[model samples]
Structures are given as structure tokens and as C-alpha cells.
Target: MLYRFKSQATADLVMLVADAQGALRLIGKDLTPEGVISPDQLPWAIDILQHAWREDNDLGLREDTYATEQLAEQDDENPDVRLSQRLVPLVNMLELANKAQVAVVWSAS
Candidate 1:
């Protein structure tokens, strides 16, 4: 399954359900069928996500829950994709939505 995030301020964003859920979980959101992040909430959401990403990158504390040993090994042999990397697009979308005073919404499919 996939989640499609829409924002009046930015292009539509699509992500695998796992990736979207991982990031949303950081901000205390569940991967429901649909949801919204209001403009007022964007700053806090962005902060939480960026902080978690930084901590994961700098301290390597959080396990990449989506990755298995086999995938980890494959990543080592190829270009790596980290939680931090996966969160960037979502963060960018939120930032833009905040600036434009619009809401960010997502629906599971």
C-alpha cells in the first residue's frame, strides 16, 4: 500500500505506507486511512521529525525499523536510504504548507 500526501502549497507526495507511517509515528500520528496536518501544527511536526532524524543520523540511536538484515546488507552494497533521507520530502512539504498557510493531508491507498 501507499500513502498520498496532498498540500495546497506543494506538489502531491507519494510514499510507501511503511515510510509514511514511520515518520507520522514520530509526530504522534497513526497511519489512519486519512488525516490532516493543519498549518498551525506544521512547525511542531517539522521540529519533531527533524529532531528525530538528526538524532538518528548523529547518534545512530534509533533502529531503522523498516530495514531487515538482508536489506541492510543490500544497502551497504548500494546507495543507502535512511530514515533521515525518507523524511526530507515530507518535511519539505510541511514547511511549504506552513508558509503558504495551508493544510497537509494524507490518505492511505
Candidate 2:
């Protein structure tokens, strides 16, 4: 599954199931079929995500929860790019959306 997030404040942000759901959980949300993030919630979500990006040394929940046997076949030239890398786009999206006071919505595909 994939989750595509969108807001009037920024371009759409797309993520795979594990990564997207893991992020939702970070802000204390369940993996629902559909969800929305009000601008007011951006700060809390952003805080947790930045914390994980700085602290988690492993591939993180994003990879562990989603990776399959075939994941082993993929090269890890830069495993660091897996979970933490996603923060960049998300952070940018949340920050901009927050400033614009727009809601971020997501749904599975």
C-alpha cells in the first residue's frame, strides 16, 4: 500500500505503507484508511520525526515493518537514506503547511 499526502500549502508527498504509517504512529495516530493532519498538529509530529531521525541508528520501523525477503536483494549503498531521509520532505511539507494554516490529508492507495 501507499499513502499520498496533500495540502494546499505544498506539493503532494507520497510514501510507502510502512513509512507513511510509521510516521502517523509517531504522532499517536492509528493506521486508518484515511486521515488528516491539521496545521496545529504539525509541530508535535515534526518534533517526533526529527527526534527519530537523529536517534534511530537502524533502518527504523519504516524499513523493518515494510521490508520483504526481496529487500535483501536490494543494495544498501546508503541505508541511511531509508527512513531518516524521508524526514526532509515531510518536514518541509509540514512546516510550510503549518505556516499557511492548511490541513494535510492522506489516504491509502
Candidate 3:
């Protein structure tokens, strides 16, 4: 899947993803130039993606806790509420990772 961002602050940035044979599978175009992201920053991007993917696929009812908490805050006490709270940490980590990646890229030029 390609992700695109557009803003008035800068020119567009495009990220092209291809297969081993250089076959283009995804193209993230028109992305607000978050600046020049280098290959060295890929590790952190991969880390963030991996973590988010893991959290999304978590089957141990961990993420459910955060959802549960959210519902509980509304005074709806359901046992299933415990399953929703885990999203908080997952979201926080993802945000941090994104910011780090952006910072790295923005600092480039």
C-alpha cells in the first residue's frame, strides 16, 4: 500500500517500493517532502511498521484492554473493556517511531 501526504509547507515527496526484480509494487507519491530521508533511516521505519503490525495481530487479548478502558471511562463496565487498553501503548510507540523517522529525514537537508 502506498501512503501519500500533501501540504503547502514544501514540495511533494514520493516513495517508491519495488520487488527484488525492481518491479514497482507500491508508489507513495505527493508526500509532503518530510525532507531527505536516507537509507540509514529505514531501520527505524521498519521497526515502527513491524511493531504496529505485531500489535495489530496480537491475539492474546492485550489490545483489548485499552478498548475496554475507553469504554469504561464512559461508565460502561464490560469485561471486554480490558481488551482495548493495549492500543494506547501501541499507538504511542508508533507515534514516537514516526516522529523519529521524520526528524531524521527533516534534519538531512
Candidate 4:
């Protein structure tokens, strides 16, 4: 899976990928992308991404629950303030997409 972030806050873009085993692997040439999302921010991002994926793909509840739990654990050790800060952009992204009524595309083939 792959994710891309584009925003006015920074000139560079952010991209992340996950391998077949669900291990996240950072990609793209621009490491210091404008948005500067840290590894700590990834779980929240993944939570959103996975929710969209499951909804769009009509995934089973069991699968969704398992994934959600796993992703939630990623932020357990993070400071509350840092987690809140990280989630702000993610929530904004979701709101922006929702306002645009964007259709989340899924590939479950």
C-alpha cells in the first residue's frame, strides 16, 4: 500500500509504503518533504488509511477490528501532546477530502 500527502504547509510531498507482510517501508526520494511527518505520526495516518480502505473495499468487521487494534497500539507509547499534534493534520486531510466528497478507491482483487 502507498500513501501521498500534499499540502500548503510545505513544498515537498510525503509518501509511505507497506510491504506484503504489512511492514511499513518509507519510499520516495524526498526524505525531508515539506510536511515533515514523523514515524510517530504514521499510526494515526495508517488508521485513517485503513478505515478508508476497509470501507471502500467492504472488508469484514473482524479484519477491521484486528487492524484497528494493531494500529492503535502504535501510538500507545507516544506523548499525548505529540499524538494530538500529529492527528491534527490527519483530521484536516479527512475533512478536506470529505468536503470535496472524494470517493476513496479500493483494490481488493
Considering every candidate listed, which one attains the maximal lDDT? 1
lDDT of each: 0.86, 0.81, 0.36, 0.39
Stretches of model 1 off by over 4 angstroms after superposition: 60-76
In the range 10-91, model 4's lDDT, one tens digit per residue, is 3322323322112122212142212333434534545655554445345445555776777687856532222223334444
How would you encode candidate 3's per-residue C-alpha lDDT over 1-109 as one tens digit per residue?
3322222333333223221011111112123424333335445544544454465567435656776767767765645422224333323433454545532232112
Q: By TM-score, how accurate is candidate 1?
A: 0.81
Error of 1 at 48 (Å): 0.3
1 against 2, candidate with superior lDDT: 1
| Model 2 C-alpha lDDT versus the unseen true structure | 0.81
- Candidate 1 structure quality by residue, lDDT tens digits, 1-109: 9999999999999999889999888988866899999888899999999998897676443344444555766765553577788899999999999989999999999
| lDDT of predicted model 3 | 0.36
* Candidate 4 pairs with clashing backbones: none
Root-mean-square deviation (CA) per prediction? 5.2, 6.5, 14.3, 13.1
Better of 1 and 3 by TM-score: 1
Model 3 ranges off by over 4 Å: 1-36, 59-109
Shift of residue 93 alpha carbon in model 1, Å = 0.3
| Rank ordering of all candidates by TM-score, starting from the highest | 1, 2, 4, 3
Model 2 over residues 1-107: C-alpha lDDT tens digits?
89999999999999989888888988788799899988788888878888887666355664566665546778664344556777678878888888898988999
TM-score of 2: 0.75
Model 2: CA > 4 A from native:
57-80
